[model samples]
Target: MGALSDVRVVDLTQVLAGPYCTMLLADMGADVVKVERPGGDLIRSSPPHLDDPEAEPYGGYFQSVNRGKRSIELDLGADDDRETFLELVETADVVVENYRVGTMESFDLAYETLAERNPELIYASIRGFGDPRTGETDRQGQPSFDIIAQALGGVMEITGAEDGPPMKVGPGIGDLFTATLNCIGILGALHHRERTGEGQYVDTAMYDSMLSMTERAIYLQSYQGSPPTRCGNAHPTLFPYNAFAVADGYVVVSAFGTNHWRALCDGIDRPDLADAYPRPADRLEHREEIHAELTEWMATHTTDDVVDRLEGSVPVAPVQDTDAIFGDPHVHEREMLYEVDQPGAGETVDIAGSAIKMSKTNPKPRGRAPLLDEHREELLAELAAQHEAISEK
Candidate 1:
């Protein structure tokens, strides 16, 4: 059993942000009931399918985020299906969704209605701008995705090269970060409910999350009256703290401190540079010159050679790709990758494991993502039995 083994969640979410939130909850042992529309999640048709052509509906994109959850098909447009969803909600501890601003209200299944049916229901929503209950935005009804969030929230502005156009981060931090924050909000609401026997609506916006992620820029803009701009791989406040090109690929080196700078200079056989620039301010003043010298020195050595020379004294690492990560001993030692049986492909596939480690209540994926309506009959029977028991009382 995991930490949240007793909790049940009605997951009415699709795509990355909402499903990723419930994925974490499910990893922590919440009984996540994924309520999908008849056509199923759009990501199910996304690319990178397994070898088998006859496999089930979903591909890797869907499988990665929707794992270890029970799936039930429900069309809220239909009266009976809507009633069934409400019944499931009545028995659930939490209900989460990532629909448009007023979609739930249109279906007459908003948090207000769900909370009325189950007073202690923790209703959570993930939106692009956020729910009005928190703070209404001018863009409340406007649709958004990860790229939009990144561009509008100051993240793209401060990323990439100083000379290039604003760039979005490689991964969808906009969606993933919002999902993580929403999960935290849900956990906090759950704690409050445990104490007071009352639940509340919780939400996080992708744009808001991106703004929070770029907090340093916000403060700089406020204090210095200047917006932060991209500085390429170098940090705004630190020098000799950027990626350097080696013989084979690149390696990031950070010799920001005085001792580290001296060590780096000694390692690269440039003791004169260390003597000339002792302080960080001095180094920053001559950033271009020092960077050039370092670059020249680094180009002379391979990544492995540089690592061997500076591993203990300087913070340095080769820029690695997924293949390198897969073979890294540290990854295996930390249990960051898991191999799970995929029923559709009839083979085991590797998926990322949980980062949140615990001594006793270790959280993990319970199983693979469920087939469409796979648990519908079992769930209906369980709900019927629950209703009958309540009626008997």
Candidate 2:
């Protein structure tokens, strides 16, 4: 059993951010019941599926993030379904969702309504802007995805090559980061409830999350009176903290401190470079010359050779692809890849494992993502049992 084994979560989230947060809760041993609409989540049909879509239920996009949760379909628009949902909430420790503002209100299932049903319920929401219960904004009703948040929240402003256009990050940081923050808020609310026997609302916005992530740029702009722009693979302030092209592949080197810089110089057999650029400022001042010299040397050596020479002396790593990551012994040792049965895929496939590690009650995914409404009968039985137990009381 995990640390949160006793907690039950009513997950009314669809698509990426909301489902991802509930997935984390499930990993920590929460009994997460995913309350889907009649047709199910929008991303269930996202491509790259096996030959049999019906047996598989969903593609990799849905499977990757929605693991370890029970699914039940309910049409919130219907009165009977709404009553059933409220009953589920009455027994839940948490209620999480990621919908546009006023969505729950339309179904008459707002946070206020749910809190009335279960006073100790932690109501958490991940929105593009935020719910009005916390704060209202002009963009409250606007639907947004990862790219919109990245562009509006300053992540795109400082990404990409210096001369190139602003770019979205390779991964969906907007959704993922927002979801993680919302999870933290939910955990905090749970703690508060444990202390005071009172639950509260937790709100996280994707735009806000992206802005918080790009805090470095904000501080730099405040101090220098100008916003920093993209610098390709280089750090704006730190010299030799960038990716360099080796003969076979690219390797990143971080020689920020004086000792590491000296070690890098010695490892590369260029002690004179260390003598000339002894201080951090000196290295920053002559970064172009230093980069050119390092690049010239790296052009002759393979990524492995560079790593071998600087492994213990300086912070260095090859720019790894998925192939390298899959084959890495360290990754396997850390249990960062979790394998699960992929319905129609003929064999088990791997999803990312949980990063949270504890000495006792370690968190991990309980099982694969559920087929749509797979747990409907099971969940209904559970609700019936609860009703009987309450009647006896």
Candidate 3:
């Protein structure tokens, strides 16, 4: 069994961050019961769906993060459904939600209410800003998404070509990072509960997570008295740590360290470079010259040629697209990709596997994402059985 096999989580989240957080817990064998509204999660109807009639009702967006969780429909606005959720909370170790600051209060199911019902319940929230209980802000209850967080978090400020407009990152780092932190918070709270037999609120804000992630930029600005700006793929503090275009494609080189720089010079058959720019600061001062020299040399070789020449000597990697990642032997051997049979689809699809590897109790997705309210009957029966057993006791 997984480490968290005995833990139960009531997942009252939709879309990305919250669901992804609970998915991490579920992967570790938490019994995550997703409490959906009457119509189900907004992402259930998201795009990139299969053409087959027998395919899973939802699309890739929903399937990717919601895997290994049980789903049950509940209209929290209704008194009966609210009471049902309370009953579920009393039996759960954790309850996670990502909604506006006051949304839960509207249903009279806020953390305060749930904590009263079950004093040992771990309640976590993933909000755009943060809940008022932990910290208050004027931006509380303001709607936000990945892009908004990216822009506000200073990520966009330092993310593009030096002279170009600010750009959003390729992936949803705003949501994903916040989710990971929130999961960490939940785990910490769980540990605290284990020690004290008490549960407390755990809160994570996307904006806050973004600010935390851009720590390097913050420190640079403070130390230099100048805010760092975008310089394409180059790092501000290191030289020869940028992507360059080869004949076939792009390859990133990270030969900023003294030994690695020497190795790079040797790999390129240019011992003079190491002698002329002995120190990393010297190389940084002559960044344009170094970039141009590398660019000229790179144009003569293919990505493979560059990688082959510098593979073991210097930190180098050819920029790989998703297709390359899918076919990579190292990726397969590491089990970074997982294939699961879609619930209703006759075909199997690949999803990203967990990165948390363990010697014992290795965590993995228990199964496919559930169909809407698919486990309603089974879950309600379980709850009813628990209630009956408690009454008997």
At residue 3, what lDDT does model 1 achieve?
98
Residue-level lDDT tens digits of model 2 in 40-60: 999998966767644586878
In model 2, what lDDT does residue 33 have?
A: 95
Flag the better candidate by lDDT, 2 or 3.
3
> Hey, what RMSD does candidate 1 come out at?
1.2
How high a TM-score does candidate 2 get?
0.98
- lDDT by residue (57-138, candidate 1, tens digit) is 5777888899999999999999999999999999899999999899999999989999999999999999999999999878
Q: What is the lDDT of candidate 3?
A: 0.93
User: What Cα-based lDDT does every candidate model obtain?
Assistant: 0.93, 0.92, 0.93
Comparison by TM-score, 1 against 3, better one: 3
lDDT (tens digit, per residue) of candidate 3 on 1-393 = 998999999999999999999999999999999999988999998978888888877988888899999999999988888888998999999999999999999988888899999999999999999889987889999999999999999999999999999999999999999999999999999999999999999999999999999999899989999989899999998999999998899999999999999999999999999999999999999999988998999989998889989999899998999999999999999888988777677888888999998889999978889899899899889989998999999
- Backbone clashes for every candidate come to 0, 0, 0
Error of 1 at 115 (Å): 0.6
